[model samples]
Target: MAEPFHIGFLLFPNLTQLDFTGPLQVLARLPGAKLHLVAKTKGPVETDCGPFLLADTDFNDCPKLDMLCVPGGFGIDQAMQDADTIAFVKRQAEGARYVTSVCTGAFILGAAGLLKGKRATTHWAWHSHLARVGAEPVKARVVRDGNLFTGGGVTAGIDFALTITAEIAGESVARAIQLGIEYDPAPPFDSGAPDRAQPETLEICERRYAGRVADFEAALAAALG
Candidate 1:
């Protein structure tokens, strides 16, 4: 029998729900996978979209995981500066076979000094911030530098999880899972990315993230120092 594979997602207040749940829907199907939603405490973690997710284990009680995934949102503006969160992530990465993040969660890993000198990526608006933490940011949905993996933005986590599934279990297993989930993305609009978006669409996106980008940069600066 295959050994049990423990997968963990770091839960925090104000995370983008899609970043955590999108990947959850896919990675949960990995054969022999046991999922752990971990946080500073076994309490309610809120999402940016006004929903709440419960973390099953606190950092102290969580089992050693085979994989650890951090999900991003505006909450990351605060999470990146949290010492306990950074320490827990740093500690978990030391033993996990795969260390990964979705969207701006990469900055939390950056806070732990995990991304130093690594090729990584994050949400397009914040891609430049990667270099502040010593990461060479790439412009792609999924990027892997050794054992570290990063997803571009919220919805990109689904693709990121599938890629990791292919790496660990193989193409066949990943394909089966993708098929089972009917993971076909056919959005009615072609504005998912910055380059493809109409100028007005890009403007709205920029406006939405304008304040957040500023706050996150300040947090990132404080966290790194």
Candidate 2:
């Protein structure tokens, strides 16, 4: 029998749950897929939103994956500075068919030197930092540059998953999965982007995120070091 397509999502403390779960809802349905939730150690990892998730495998035990996914959230600052995590990503990406990330997770990939000269995207708040890590940032929901795929913000992971599914299993398979999940989105809000959001709304968001920017900048420098 053919080998199951082994896929792993790197798990860490304080990551955005939707960044990983949204994509998992789609990719888990791919034909022949075997999913692994990986971490530096085997145990529960907390999400930014307060839930704890178990890491099914640790770095030493994780087999070389067919696909490697990293999710981003408030904990991204710490992840970027984590030597073991960066080394694991670099090692897996060396053999994986695809190297992908969601939201600020691309920052982790960039830290591993996978985004050099590659076009990528991340949460709009952190898009400017991509260049600091040597990636050419594109402001898109999903940016695909060769085997590197990146999703912007939190919910874009769903869109990224379908795109990756199509790339791996063919469009028909992706379409079937989409229909199965009723993936059609008709969001009631039009203020998702900076260009569309009211000035006051943007200011409020900027204020909320202002305090974390310095921490991120420091982490990026450490990661790139």
Candidate 3:
């Protein structure tokens, strides 16, 4: 029998639930996979939008993971400056087969010093921020540099997990999982990307996220220095 794959996903306050849950759904189906929802402590963690998820284990209790996954959201702004959280990620990533993140989670990985010189991607708004941590930011839904895998924005976690699934299991297994999930995505609109969105729509989003961008940049500067 194949060895059980121990996979840990970092959970924290204000995370975008989809970033974690989307990947969790795919990875949980992997053959011989054990999933761990880890946090600084074992308890309920709230999302930016008010959903609560219970953490399965505290960092101290988690076994060395085969893969360490981080999912990002507004809370990531604070996580980047958190020594304990960053230390946990660094410690797990040191021995993990894959160090991965979704969306702004890349910033947390950067703060851990894991992204140095690696090709990575994050939310479109934070593409320029990757350079602050010495990472080469690639514009794509998913970017893989060796064992470091990063997914862009909120909805990209599904794609990222399938990519990891294919790498660890096989394309056949990945395809089967994708089929099970009915992963065919047909969006109602073509405004998912900045380039495809109308000028007014982009402007509104940019304006709404400007403060968040500033906050993240400040946190990254502190974490990197």
lDDT of 2 by residue, 1-225 (tens): 878999999999999999999999999999999999999999999999999999999999999899999999989889988989989999999999999999999999988889999999999999998998889999999999999999999999999999999999999999999999999988898789898999999999989998888788887887778
Indicate the residue-level lDDT of 218 in model 3: 79
Q: Which pairs clash in the backbone of model 3?
A: none
- What lDDT is obtained when candidate 1 is compared to the true structure? 0.94
TM-scores of the candidates in the order shown: 0.98, 0.98, 0.98
Candidate 3 minimal-lDDT segment of 10 residues? 216-225
Off by over 4 Å in 3: none
Error of 3 at 56 (Å): 0.9
Candidate 1, residue 125: how far the Cα is off, in Å: 1.0
lDDT of each: 0.94, 0.94, 0.94
| Displacement of the residue 133 alpha carbon in candidate 2, Å | 0.7
Candidate 1: Cα lDDT at 28: 95
* Alpha carbon deviation, residue 96, candidate 3 (Å): 0.3
